[model samples]
Target: MAYQVLARKYRPRRFADVAGQDHVTVTLMNALTQQRIAHGYIFSGHRGIGKTTIARILAAALNCRNPIGSELRPLAEPCEVCESCTEIRAGNAVDVIEIDAATNRGIDEIRELRDAARYRPSRDRYKIYILDEAHQITDAAFNALLKTLEEPPDHVIFMMATTQPEDIPQTVRSRCQHFSFHAVKLVDILGEIRAIAAHENVDTDEAALALLAEAGDGSMRDALSIMDQAIASAPVEDGRPRLVAQQIRELMGTVPNAVFERILQAVNDNNSAEVMTTANQLLDAGNSPAQLARQAVRYLRNSLIAKISGLTPESAEGGAAAELLQISPDEQRRAARTAALFTEEELTRFLQTMLRTFDELGYRQEQRFHFELGLLKLVHLRRLLPVEEVLSQLAGGGGGSAPRAQSAVRPVAAAPAPRPTAPAAPADTRPAFSPFADTPNRERFQGISVGHQPEPVPVAKTAPPVAAPLPVAPPVPVAPPVAVAAPVSPPPALGVPPVVAASPLATPPGAAQPVAAPVEVVSPFSAPSTPPPPVPAPAPIPVAPPAAVASPFSAPAPATPVAAPPAPAPSAPGEPASHLQDAVVDALSNAKQGSASDAIGDANFILDGDTLKIQTMLSKIMLGVVVNADAEKILRLAVRQAGGPVNITLLPADPAMKAAEKKAKAPRSGSAQAKAMEHPIVQRAQSLFQAEIRNVIDLRED
Candidate 1:
């Protein structure tokens, strides 16, 4: 007779024989008793978990020839004595057809099976077809089987099984009743195998059996096979050499817990030499570098679980692994005690490093380099503390570092020193940057520091922005330019005379007009373009409140051959006009100078609104400044310095029109009036209208 391996020798023959699957067996037995069997059955589960075994048992029960009932009904369990049951068990039952779909997965083979399935069973209660690895069938074969699988003949039953349930098509799977099987637990696997070992009369200890069972990973057949191999190799001692864990480790080349403990101790000691030396010893013992890395990960993973759950060694996976690996109790205690050396963060980091080493071993051609460097790296790495602890140390709120340098940790001593009566030194005010010296704003940016940025120089309050606005011809109405200056400002106190401003060419009122000045700019003939009414000395203009009293005309009105009046100084008699202007400009320039200082020069301001506003007549460049944003900023600063702090805004100025009057008496040129009347567009209009041209007027066409 030929020898049978333990996997097949211990194969389950009955549903009750399938261990760890009582849930499935109990349900199936009830279904059999009630005679409510599904014609199409699909069993899905991992390998070596009794999927095919259970399917064969179902076939046997369905085809059993012997009866157990008092009258004639057959039992769900096979009698095992009759021809049908015996032949099926022996794999020779003609009525029971078994197919390895992995080898015969073509559509033609499935079609042939479908045709043969139509025939009635040959001298049996029913015909059964058990197809294994059903997912290996091609799409065409699955499609061909769908119809037959869904509605098969009453005499035929279909059973399908696969390790990979996901690969099977839903169309085929939906036609069948599905049952799922799970891996047997570690305890159950060891209990069964140890019983088998005792029956075989092999004196095996708990350590050897546990190691074989753990290597099984969850499958009973796998555990039995590993044990069978170990038993065969067992040397004879007192009729049987006890199967020892050391022998098993040698056979399997597994890294024992001692190696993991040694590496961890070296890491705690920060001894790179010991870490590398211990790792190499494992490699010398015939364990692969990746396997060593995996062992370290397992050890650390167990430690983490134990630490978090507060579980003792007996209750944790680490205890099981240690017992199975044959690690001595004293060595296990030493390793377990080291768990105190790691914080949660440190444990997490250690696990990460080991996992990375394991992954890199697969892609790296130099596995030895990865193994040596990995353990050394862990030794060199510093342990990490919790974030809260580090923060508290920096804040001087947590316990200080250890005294006398017992540990590597250095405490943060950032608590402030007591301040003296004198103020602390201000941050360096001098500029440290010199690279921008070539730019146009270099001078302005100089002497500016982070904490002490250069402030805009405030305007002197002795005089308001010196403005004397001239009425120019109205421009085509465009979008109003944004005003960046303050209100119709405090009048310029020392520039143009206020009373003399009644006429464009008139001198100061209440002051004698000088005669025979070479700067006489009177034109021989002037057009009637301006009003002749003498506006009061201090009465405000109605059209546009002015930003400054600028000398509007290009012809110099002789530098009033006399010193202008000193500005009204701000007094305890309430804030003076100049001071109010200064205050308002200062507040504006300091706060919003970057955006709001553009209308400083051109604004015809209105000081009535809470926010000073520029009138629309804000016009052409004044004093060679662009009358734009930069100019506006400078002028605002000046007002702030000269006057006092005042809030500034830009609103449209007053819109009252100026009074229009005849031009004052002056000599008129005959040639100029004749020239105006002789123009072709004018002549055509006069002729077309049959009107006479009289007293021609010049519109100053230039």
Candidate 2:
């Protein structure tokens, strides 16, 4: 006989001889024993897991001229001595026809097979058609044979074996008995390889046998094929081939898992130099960077699995670890030891990094740089803390020193300042008392208590029970000189008025203020012949409620106390309002409202009698910022600062209004776009981000 590969030489003849497929074998055996055979059978699973082999054995068992054992107790296995079994095993059976579906997957071939299936057997009890790689058949071809496969004649049987069962049409699959085969486990492959090596009289160590089994990757045919290659390459000793682990490694062109284990150990130690050195050594030894990356990915995956399952060599037997990690015992132990140095998450991240690096090596020009960088990434990734841990540290509620460091660095201002002394009344804890919280009291102005009038009124004879003692005193006539001489440091007993009077423009409220005097000089006609004499301020605009008072001595107050009073409708001041425009523009620009500042800066400012008019041409986007309520308030405040108050009119150019009207008239309805525009959350986001809605997709079902 010619030299035969181990895959073929050790091919299982009877169902009982098949390994790692007891589920399929035992079920087929039961079906044979009961003689409840289906006309159409489909076998599908991983490659080389006996899908076609089981199909052929079932064929032999069905047609055996003299099946083993007696009628009372029949063995479901085929009788090898029978001529039908011998011809089938030798692939020369007259009645059995094996077709390579990959080559003949057209409708014409299927039509021929359909016509042939109608005939009776030539010599055997039944005619059998075994189609290998059946998934390769075109959809048209499967459709052509669907009717025949569904109701084949009793004299014919159709058996198909395919790696991808889903590629076969559902109509064809429904009519056939579909058996999904499992990938042969590592333990089963190891035992089978050991037996084959013994039978072939080849001397092999346990590591060499394990290596052969692992190289198969859970396929008996693949394992046997690798064994054949290993035996051919093994050195002959004492007239027999000797298979060693080192020789097998060289034949496979792969470094041992130990190389990766060492790399990971360096990573755990955060030694980037060692990692790069190891990668350099592996490349120098002639291992391809892409191949090295692939091996690293595999090793990392095994380590991740070991970390997750806590699988050691001694504990890996007959469990998920055995099925998941299909390597030898030594590899499992190596993976476990490596996994111990890193956490499950770190292993997962390492696997992910290597997986990405492996994919990049396929298309990247600089493979060596990417491979080294990928290894260096593993070293750096070890230093990273999980997001949950970081968050816990930030919360200052975790056990690690990270939380302590986080708490130590926190700003002292984060906590409220301690009160020097408690108030006579208990502080209000109600939400209404909070500045941010809304309260009805915030809407209107409150009463103001003036200490004295400018006309030198007499002091009150008796303190009114409703009035405070401080407001009963008359104003001192000599105070203006003392306040205007220079900046005054407030005295301990100086009240709120002294603080206001001590500012740079301390001339009486009615005087031509020093800041506003320059605006008059720009226009001769707008200036008065002589400046108006200083006049006492009018009754200080009614003060806010006591709770809203802004005083350094008092508790923190709401922003309402500092709000500028509404500008009067008309005030005939004797100066042009250019100073007001400059102030408004400067304020807007400093507030980061650049577009608004530009619009205002380009505007024409006219002081007609008592009204101030601002006119500018702006785009619709800029018009929104210029006319914003906050911007309007700032404009009015600037006018108040320039003089008493005046009517302020902002006239956006007609083109801007026309553009805005056109946009508003643009179609909007109850569609997703309209709803998204009108959504409160969406509107708030638009305002906050200064964005507009361009499109909206409705993902909800109709």
lDDT by residue for model 1 over 554-626, one digit each (tens)? 2323222211232232233222243343443445456555223333322333444333433332323332333
Residue 528, model 2, lDDT: 17
Error of 1 at 476 (Å): 80
TM-score of 2: 0.61
* TM-score on alpha carbons, each prediction: 0.55, 0.61
lDDT of 2 by residue, 1-702 (tens): 799888888899988888889999999898987788999999988998898888889999989988546662269888777888999999999999999999999999999988888888988999999999999999999999988887789898999999989999999999999998999988889899888788888999998988888888889899888888889988999989999999998998899888898999988777788998999999999889998998898898888888888886568555777578888777888888898887788888888899999999999998999999999988878877766766665466575445321122323212223223211222222212223123232212111111111122122233223222233223323322211222212111112222222221222345444332111001100111222333344333322111112333322211111112332233244444556677777777667765576567656567776678776666556677666888777667666655524578777667646456434533234445677888899889988998876555668764
- What candidate 1 gets wrong by more than 4 Å, as runs, is 67-75, 314-348, 380-382, 386-702
